[model samples]
Target: MTAVNSSDEIAPSRMLHRLTVLIVCLVWPLIWVGGLVTTYDAGMSVPDWPGTYGYNLFLYPYKTWLFGPFDLFIEHGHRLLGAVVGFVAIGIVIAAFWKENRRWVRWLCVALLLMVIAQGALGGVRVVLSDRTLAMVHGCFGPAFFAICVILAVVTGRRWRQDSDAERLRSSTSILTPTKKLAALAISLVVLSYVQLLLGAMMRHVQPTTSAGHFAGIVSTHILTAFFLWAMTGLVWLRLRRCGDLTLSRPGGILIFLVAVQIALGIGTWVVNYGWPSFMTWVPGSQSFLVQAKGFVDSMIVTGHVATGSLILAVSAMLCVRLFHRRWQAKQDRLVAT
Candidate 1:
């Protein structure tokens, strides 16, 4: 096996890494658009699968699509963006095959390709079946895919592949115990975020089909989980700061900031969707600011909340991967020294 030095091996890998980052950027907005589709109740706007009004997805008249009803515009735009992401996924897979030597990395690329395909199929099936439950499932899958993109970007980075032996020795000697705990904490945050998102999706879709009591229960769980998510994410940020690793601390700070924003957005979403909770109505001038459901500002706030939640998950996943990689490199360094 050939030894892969950073300077000698980075050019080809850099291209692949950049492509992965592009995919991550693309996926972020795709998620936001998906959220908007739900916010405006536009999931069924086009009333067809893999196409718009019986026209092939790309062949849909740009004039009509661009100038159509608001629901049609967002729904079709979401599908188009999904297709672009899918194409980028294909590019990543091809680049991985040609440029990547690591077996797991190549397979991870393939898995990402498969995931995009599955996500598209899920969206199409949701439309054809006219199933809100499936739409909720589809909604949950977008963030997971976005998280995978982030992981791929992190793993393929120059820093990840080029950890110096001296740096690893320093890291290994500094805070091995704390690193493990932070890694576990990061993983726990990801899991909790996903669960909360699922609860959110349930609350979102259940209101139209199921009873209000069921929706209320899901909302209660979602709201209660927010505090826990906020606290744990903050703890992770503090721990990372103590660990004194700038790479990890940077994203840790981002995670904490995002959690704060997400919490505020959650409250805003509630106000927009439910006309301000009764508890808040007692506040002076609160009545004047109550938001009407499905209005433009309401849609944007809710969509921003959903998009930020996805970003939080992505950052958590990236942090977890970096921490685990550092720990693994430290173990390797100890063995090499021995």
Candidate 2:
């Protein structure tokens, strides 16, 4: 909404920003592998928590896991990646506390550390109890954890750090430039998309427990949410684009692209899992299509759908933060000019 003032530039701890970026990079692949595990019903491959087949997770025989059954390889690899992310979470806080001048940012890093720990425990307990519901919960929390990492990555970077000492703008609708509406709309989209994600999880992990009628309701709701999320994302993109700020418009563009890809993937996921819908039966080649359960094409499509949903949330988080950052910096600049 406003040009970044060169005179306003401030340096942040390079190590903290680097660690934050590293975790953000690592978390997305972790989500993809987790999605794959779910796609193939490989949650129980290791049947142990914090370990692989009773061996220390890191010390587990590579020959067995690396060359083991496909499910075991993915499941164990997912655990290994999670462990690595957990360690990075610790490093993020240490770097933030040691070098970051902002007390609130340090606390955010601490919160990130705690969230990753809780998320890890959720995954482990889901394993020990063999609870699909907890598995879904774990799946749901991963995006939120990734979101915080994205937030950390954005805030710790030079763009945000440049305004390091400005008092936080009051959380109100007054700060949006050009229009006052983007703040609440962006925030709402974040929450709505997350709800859509939960409905998706219900379909993926809790379908067996749901009765036919109940499951149909969920499917209907999921479809409706996707339509609504698509429209909301479009609206946000337009607003961000019109703002004429590259930093803001770029994330908005990324969000819209992810949503478009996600919608196509969603369709592919539906077709591969359930065949053509009754409404599409009259279309060419639709009658010959058959649902392929766990087939390579179907698995990758479904897994991509899941991972893209997380990406949508992650980018949405970045845009929301950028919007707020712009508003906050604008307000600070006005105050200084006065």
Index of the highest-lDDT prediction: 2
Q: Write the per-residue lDDT of candidate 1 for residues 157-182, one digit (tens) a residue.
A: 87775554435445455554346667
lDDT score for residue 318 of model 1:
86
Query: What would you estimate as the lDDT of candidate 1?
Result: 0.83
lDDT of 2 by residue, 146-176 (tens): 9999999988888776443444333333434
TM-score against native, each model: 0.92, 0.91
Give candidate 2 regions above 4 Å deviation. Answer: 1-10, 162-178
Clashing pairs in 1: none
Candidate 2 weakest lDDT stretch, 10 residues? 167-176
lDDT, candidates in the order shown: 0.83, 0.84
| TM-score of model 2 (CA atoms) | 0.91
